[model samples]
Target: MARRKTREEIKTQDKWNIEKMYPDNASAEKDLKESVSDAEKYGKYKGHLADSAESLADALIESDRIEQKLERAFVYSRMKLDEDNRAAEQQALYSKAAAAISQVSSLTSFVMPELIRIPEETLKQFIEDEPRLQTYRHLLDSAMRQKDHVLSEKEENILAQLGEVLSAPDQVFTMLNDADMKFGKIKDEEGKETELTHGNYISFMRSQNRQVRKDAYTHCYEAYKGMINTISANYSANVKTDVISARLRNYPSARAAALSSGRIPESVYDNLIDSVHSALPKMYEYVKLRKKLLGLDELKMYDIYVPLVKLPKKKIRFQQAVEIGKEGLAPLGDAYLQQFQKGIDSRWIDIYETEGKTSGAYSFGSYDSDPYVLMNFDSTLEDVFTLVHEMGHSMNSWLTRKTQPYVYGGHSIFTAEVASTVNETLLMKHLLKTESDPEMKKYILNMYLDAFKGTLFRQTMFAEFEKKTHEYAENGGGLTADWMNKTYDELNTEYFGPALSHDDYIQYEWARIPHFYNSFYVYQYATGYSAANAIADRILNGGEKERDDYLKFLSLGSSDYPVELLKVAGVDMSQREPVDRAMKVFSGLVDEFAELMEE
Candidate 1:
């Protein structure tokens, strides 16, 4: 068996230069101390937010500065911890950062409620009178929208101080999943023993060897099955937290509270489900095609992930994958590509999977720091896509932070997902157009089809589960292990249709997903996939105008409402046209796949 590499064993160039954030642990602690001091400075401005235009402007700027320090400190610590969860020193750094952030939150809890106390007319007058406040026009307007939801300063302080407690479920699950639990071992495709990890589980599921896939699937979920009771309890607590927090904030539902900050309408959420529900038949047809190609007596949950258009085994090494990503993303023009290359050269990515590292791909960092990416690269073609997907996210942050003010220096979760998926869509387009191998072309098509199924259909299923489970808890239904398993089982049965048979243990799959910790986040993957398809199509089919427009959209950050911001990129997400267009693209891909296979 090949031993998993430890954090220390990985080469320096292969890892992100997280030290760029702070020179050492002492420097990180110093940053936290600075944040705490800056947060304390907010006390003088607390009750006087509405006093004068200059006073309001100064207070808002100071608040952004305080948050900037706090976020940078927290991000640095969390990234260190994520690199290797088993390291005790890293764990302490993370706990310290988390505690400091909680303290900072409590200190600044008065800003919103106090700002809310000021009359809207007074805020507008302040905006007009204070030239400095002019830059914060959008910020003030956005904060004002939360007027009804802002709790009193004292109550908000209590909630903020309980921040760590509220987040405990996610932290506990992280330790259990990443640090403690083991999925044991399985035989590799070469018939050698290997460990089954959250990182490699998907790669194994993509195996052409059926026995390998089934063993990997069974071994992975059976471990979760063992901890099912504990996981369900944590998950239920997490859901209840969402419900209670939303109610406390006077939201009609938890989902409303989740979306309110982004100013997204409930209709967008409902529209995604309805649109995906309408398109489920297309997904079912794609499934039938998969089963027929595999020539299986009956397909099961394990069978679903294997690519129908099997090609020769080829490992896309990390360096080569980056080159492919660079070429595929060229439509974004020279400026975008230059910064991307610089990030690559500067070690903005943590490139390989190591023992005890977090088991997924994500782009995250503080606004002041480089937008760092953590990936579990396994050299599959899908891993190449994952690389580009994360780079897309980092690029969004890089551009936004470089362009927008500190307060607006991040992409809304809704638009953030679009930025990432657009890269996936564009890469597939580039691959199909450039590659000449008929089999490889078929494979790319298969990948694209599956991306649609995975992002558009699978994530929507997960989204539906989030919505239903939260609603259930809000309605007083208990989320026991048995109940969760039943709910998940029904979703799989409905989504995949008769083409796939069920593995009894597949029901426990929900317990393992980390995104459930972030309520209402998965649906953005679906909605974003839909919106990104439109944006990617426009860029590929149109000219410089489309590409530049899209880049501008990425740079806007949270300066405007997400739906309105999407329009700058020529994608109108406020309407159903984007989802409908994505469905059409899926149907076309399925037809093309059907043709290629028949030939």
Candidate 2:
């Protein structure tokens, strides 16, 4: 096996050009100071938005300018820190940038309440009187939509000041999981001492060697089990924060508060859970198939990730992965293809993993910068799919930035997942249509099935758990470690069904999931995957109208509500149709995979 490259060993061209945001620390510091000054000066608009149309317009414009600059500075610092978290200087830079942003947010906290205070008729007149405000119609409208939720200016300011303190749980969780936690070592198939890490836990789970998978699972969860009490306390505090904030905002539930920010209806969340529960039999069938294929007397949770039919390894280089991704995404049209090519040529991706670099992959940037991707590309088929996935996000960001102004350039996380998952779906379709090797074909089919199982089914299960836990907390129930464990364990059994044996350690899985801190965020993965499946099917089988509609959805950014934007893409997520359609697709894939294996 090839050794992983160190950051210093990786060629310059293979890394993302973060310097494009700032050539040096001195330059970043200069901009940081300028942004702080901008934020300080922005205080002049306090209690003055309702004075005149010109004042309102001026405040909005200046706020946008300050936010854009702060975003650029913050992104630069964040990328630097992610490149190597161990570096104290980079960490300090990130901290300073965060503090600067918090200060800006504190100063501007009164803007919303004051804007909400304007009479609806007067606000409409203000927009009409100041043509400049026309650009922010959606922005103003969204704030006004939350008029009932807006607290007094002083109360809002107090909440804003608590931002860092409120974030303690998430911060503590990150510090423990990423920086301090250790999972010890396990032996690989060849009996080599392999280290277990959060980054490679999934890889271990997917190992064909059942012992390795079992060892990895056991060791990983054992580490979490040791810290379960502490982690549970942190998580409970986080949940209480959510509950308190929601109540303070006059929302009936924490889930409602979280969804309202994206303008997604709580019914959409309910529909996802209900739809997935109705489709659990399909997942049960999937589990049964895996057990039969693996010839296991009884299946365990750790056995779920192993590929049913292992094929000869095919190693793709980074450049080859890029070319394949371009070909896979060609159905989207030439403009998108050209932009993707430009991003690649411009070093928009950090292409390899190195010590201290952040694990996993993400596409990130500001409105003014290129949609940059950070990837630990390893040249496996999984890596190729990841390449296309992040590109999906980048393309969406690229289009949104091009078509919308600064305020609307970033889309909601709900829509963001749809973009990335759509790419994964398209890539699977392209690979399946073109690949000739039967074993490789089976692998791809299994990959699609696994994606559905993980994204659609598993995430919905997580969504359900989050809902139940929040409800428990809202009712004044204590969120103890034993309670969380038992609750999570029961949910795991319910979702996985009778085909698999539930292990006690599996209850600790919730402690390992970092997304739980974000409060009701994982449901979007399930919903977005369902929406993407429906959209991908339309694009593949329908006419130009379908393709154009999806492209328009990408360009919309945050100009429209997420549900409405998805409707424009031909997936009405307000109903259960998309989730039902995705489940049908999963069922068909399972039937196809069984037939292929017989052949």
Candidate 3:
């Protein structure tokens, strides 16, 4: 193995040109000061929002400006900090930016309640009275729609002040998982001492060496098991916070409060869970096939990630991955393709991992800035897929920023994953159609199957766990470690079926999942994957109309509701058809993989 490069050693072309957001720290600080001043001045209109249509429109526009500025400063500082978290100065900059944002949010906190206080007819008249306010119609309407849920001004202010306190659970969970928990070390298949970490745990689980996989799994979970009590307390606090916050806001349930943010109907969440339940037999068939393919009498959870067929060794370079992604996403048309290429050429990506760099990949930027991606690129097929995935988000942001106003320029998390997963689906289709080598074909097919298993099935399992835990807390039950563990274990058994054996430590897996801190967020992964598959299929086979509609969806941002936007792209997520279609895709992939293995 080669030594990893430092941030300075990586080529300039491969790193994101975040200097576009700010030329230097000095410039960033300058903007931060300006933003604070602007926000302070903007606060003058807080109590005067309902004074007139012009007053309301002016406040909204100024608020938008301040937010856009804050986002640029914040993204730059945060990305700088992420590049090397150990740098104290970068950390300070990030902290300052965060504080500035919180200040602005605090200043503007009264805007919504004040607007909501206006009569519904008066607010509509305001929109009609001021043509300029027409640009904010959706924004104003969204606030008005929350009328039933909006509390009094004093209560809203109190909630705003408690924001930091409310976030304690997530903050504590992050510290424990990322900064404090230690997984120790284990010997790898190569007989080298390897450090066990959250980052590489999944890779170890996928090892062909069963003993190595089992050791890594046991050791990793053992660490979590040790911290189980503390983690459970923290998570329980998080659940209680969710329940209390929902009740305060008059939402019937925490899940309803969560889903309502993106205007998603509770039916969509229930439909996903129900549809997944109906598809368990297909998942069971896949598991049984895994057991037979591995020639094992019993399949363990650790055995789930190993590839069914050994793929030919093919190392894909960063540039090669970019070319492959471009080909895969070409169906979206030339303009979209050009935008993607521009992002690549303009140093919109930060490639290669360095010491202290953040783990994993993400696409982020402000409305005024170019959509940027951060990646720790290693030359593997997985890395290639991730490249396309982040690119999907980047392109979506790019299109939305270009087309929508600042207020609606960003998308919700509900629709965010759809863009990224669609890219992965298309990439898989491209590889399978073009690759002739049997082993390589099997490899890509297996990757597709694993994606479904992980994203669709595994996340749905997580979704179920989140729902149950929240329900338990809502019913006046305590979320003790044992209760969470037993509930998780039962769900694991139910989802994976009798074909797989669960290890004892596997029951504590919930303690290790960071997503649990974000209330009811994982369900989007399942629904978004399903929606992506349906949209990708249409774009690939349904011709120009489909491609145009999908592109239109990407440009929509928050202009319309997520489900409605998806419908425009030919995927109605409210119904069960999309989930069923995705399961059929999963079933077909399993059949193909089993047949290919026999050959």
Candidate 4:
């Protein structure tokens, strides 16, 4: 049996094979030099772009080519570091590539503002006059879309220069959390011990012993308590970054600015939060019943993940997880299913748990090749869900690339989670029906309910917290630790209701969530889950037309904004219907589970 790997072993595995990115150090150096030369070429075209339509088209094409190369280098470097964090050489290479990207961005920043300055009618004429320029019409239109937010070149340069320092809060927190922090051993009921680290916390939380779950939660927070102030400062700085950026861009609020990035309307955010809020009573009822099922005197956060039903010793190996995933996804039709099988056969997935291996799971790739998924498999129920989730991302990339051009190959993050979560919903439904064992069916149902609660309700709470903080900062409210805790505590009370006690340590959760620092981002997880559940229902059970619509949505890439794409996918998130439908699903699950328990 393969046990967890040590950091040293992981580093030695040559797991990433980053040379596949650039061939060797020499090739990387050559690319770096070529990119710098490309930067110079783009720089020369900056102010002189009004020569002619064809000239403008050629210049824009060259700039995109330069960007594509730089992007590839960055992807390769970043993936290497993720594969094995302890590799010094790969880290150094990533650093170099990062610096190169910054340099390239600075050189090309002049392109957009200058393009926006061109009269819209004149630009349209350019497109009409030059057939070659039509290919770039969307790119030009997107640049023009930001005309309201564009600043003078000098102001933009100042923001660029401040980027590193401004982003310090997130950077310092990442270093402290991912690299430094450590929690001591957690002792289970039988006295067996496991070291508590970020990567292993999930595994420990699933422990059968109630004491083990409580200890892991307490110890993990205890470790974070000492660094609470530092984390708080980091979060506050992030809030401030959004405020300052939004103010500079002349936006009404930071939330507006973030939504505008993907052309999302603020109504989408509000609708999701409002819809989820109305459904909290159902969620609370589920929790109360869960506590009763566990036979606990009172419920704490630690009780959430304990299995409601136990299977009779089914051990899903990492390989078996892949097979199950492929089988579960096969209903999407043969083309979608075949690529996933190819992904498994090609070893596109880096499977198994090892010390220092990255925690969580993700699928990432450039337009250059097949997508790769990184997972630390512990053969647990959640791991299977994660496999399906990441595969959703990978398969989305695969299908999108096949159907769209290189420029539009990637979809926005707003819609990305829907693809992943939809796969998970389908997988759970498939499992519930196919598994004849009553216990297994119940377990699968529990898993499905847990997904909705965790992904939708929990994340919406974070989203509400995020929106409040941004508004507070934008309105001249201080982002001090005290302010954050007070705001978060109130939101917790509102969402969780009075049945359960809100602990002081829960306040520190705002400090620990990495997503907040990324700004106005967590809400997508909530919205996406809702959107996915609705869309997945149609795709799975609504027959041929729904399936074709879903495939078209996947193939959309960036052809339209997220809202437009989702509308085509049969979920108009701009309206509140999807949110209401999803919450209704949550309520239905609670009712069904409660009835089953009564029987």
Q: Deviation in angstroms for 508 in model 4? A: 1.7
Better of 1 and 2 by lDDT: 1
Whole-model lDDT values for every prediction: 0.91, 0.89, 0.87, 0.78
TM-score of 3: 0.95
How far is each candidate from the true structure, as Cα RMSD in Å? 1.0, 1.6, 1.9, 2.3
lDDT of 2 at 97: 81
- Estimate the TM-score of every prediction: 0.99, 0.97, 0.95, 0.95
Candidate 2 lDDT over 193-225, as tens digits, reads 867765567877888999999999999999999
lDDT string for model 3 (443-549, tens) is 78888988998898899999999999999999999999999999999999999998998779889988878888888889998999999999999999899999999
RMSD of 2: 1.6
Please tell me which model should have the higher lDDT, number 1 or number 4: 1
Worst 10 residues of 3 by lDDT: 171-180
Query: Which wins on TM-score, candidate 1 or candidate 3?
Result: 1
- Candidate 2 residue-wise lDDT at 292: 89
Clashes of each: 0, 0, 0, 2
Candidate 1 per-residue C-alpha lDDT over 1-599 given as tens digits, one digit per residue, 9 for 90 to 100? 96689888899999999999998888898989888887887799978888899888899889888888888889999999999999899899889999999999999899889998899999989988999898888888988999999998899999999999999999999999999999999998999999999888998899999999999999988899999999999999999999999999999999999999988988988888898888888888999989899999888889888988778888898899988998999998988889988998999999998989999989999999999999989899898899889999999999998899898898888999999999998999999999999999998999999999989999999999999999899999999999999999999899998788767988999999999999999999999999999999999999999999999999999999999999899987878889988988999999989988999
lDDT of 1 at 32: 90
TM-score rank, highest first? 1, 2, 3, 4
The residue pairs that clash in candidate 1, if any, are: none
